[model samples]
Target: MDPLLAKIEYWILDCVENEYSYLWEIRSVIEQRLVDVDKAKLDEYLCMGLSSVLTQGYVQAFAGIDFRGEEQLVPGFSISTSFIEQHKKAWQAGVEVDQDIRFLISDTGFEHYRQGCPPEYFS
Candidate 1:
């Protein structure tokens, strides 16, 4: 994986692990960690990293979370290629996603992280 992508993935996974599932929270973590990287490049890399993980089924995106903190996952919500494309486009275009949308690491993602993010999965 590209170094920037790796860093993005690390921060993403970390945020999910820490219960910071909101997109803005994840972006904040990435921004704080990679302060040297300019905004445009950071947004680009963030879009790429997020799209890759979402398409790979490693991270699941939810439409919202209820008051009880349960995810309100719509059926087939994260399965469409267009969904990922739209997310990337919106992110790069500086359009804020719906505040309720959340990204959580799936079981496979947890396992992958446990295994230390093997290069094959990333590449």
Candidate 2:
């Protein structure tokens, strides 16, 4: 794998796992510093980052995880609602989920973001 791709993957994994409080800002910085890269390649890598990684719904609230990136990272990246499939183990397991998801699963309206937008809004 390309080292730059690996580096992007690492940061993306971190964002997906725990989330970067300043995802868009840091990504902008990264993009600015990586001007030599092709835009298509960057987008491909960004999309790949999500497609290659498997995420748990209840455990991490993959669904409804709101990212406020208003095209700051990608040309048009804004998360209305990122939903993942429900996981039964999430309820039975003793581990605590992300605060955004731990108790919001049953909520009629997600505490953070519950927009009904499609996941491909960015794509």
Candidate 3:
């Protein structure tokens, strides 16, 4: 693979790790602040966090790639639309699943992100 692609992959892995760590922190906060935090609340937070990653991590990261003349960092010089679509589907599916299960799956997804292919890989 191209060195730039490798860098982008590494960046994505780091971003995903940070995102999961953030989620764990949020879960801890909820557990402490509220005796019983609703599943909906957790899911809502997860959605927001993932949205931030998509917008800030992917989109904003793309800007830096362009500035640095590493357009290949993202395929087609942009965040692949198909990757975004898959992510949207995954997010929707997560929201539709049971809350406890969703949290579990999300945690697993974080690990998968760190070690496995990014959504763009599938795209």
Candidate-wise lDDT, in order: 0.66, 0.35, 0.38
Clashes of each: 0, 3, 0
Residue ranges of candidate 2 with Cα displaced over 4 Å: 20-33, 55-61, 65-123
lDDT of 1 at 55: 70
Scored by lDDT, the top model is 1
Question: Against the hidden reference, what TM-scores do the models get?
Answer: 0.68, 0.33, 0.25
Candidate 1 residue runs with Cα over 4 Å from true position: 18-20, 65-70, 74-99, 117-123
lDDT of 2 by residue, 13-110 (tens): 43433343332332343466467878545545544443332221211222233444321232222222122122223433644444322111212222
lDDT for each residue of candidate 3 in 1-123, tens digit (9 for 90 to 100): 454344333333344454222233333443343346685464444344434434433322222212334322222222333534454465657653221111112344455455665545433
Which candidate ranks first by TM-score, i.e. highest? Answer: 1
Which wins on lDDT, candidate 1 or candidate 2? Answer: 1
For candidate 3, which ten residues in a row score worst on lDDT? 96-105
| Candidate 3, backbone clash total | 0
Ranking by lDDT: 1, 3, 2
Q: Spell out the clash pairs found in candidate 1.
A: none
Q: What would the per-residue lDDT of candidate 1 be over residues 1-123, giving only the tens digit for each residue?
A: 676687678667767864537665666777787779897666666677777777766687776535156656544444334544476577779885444567788888777777776555333
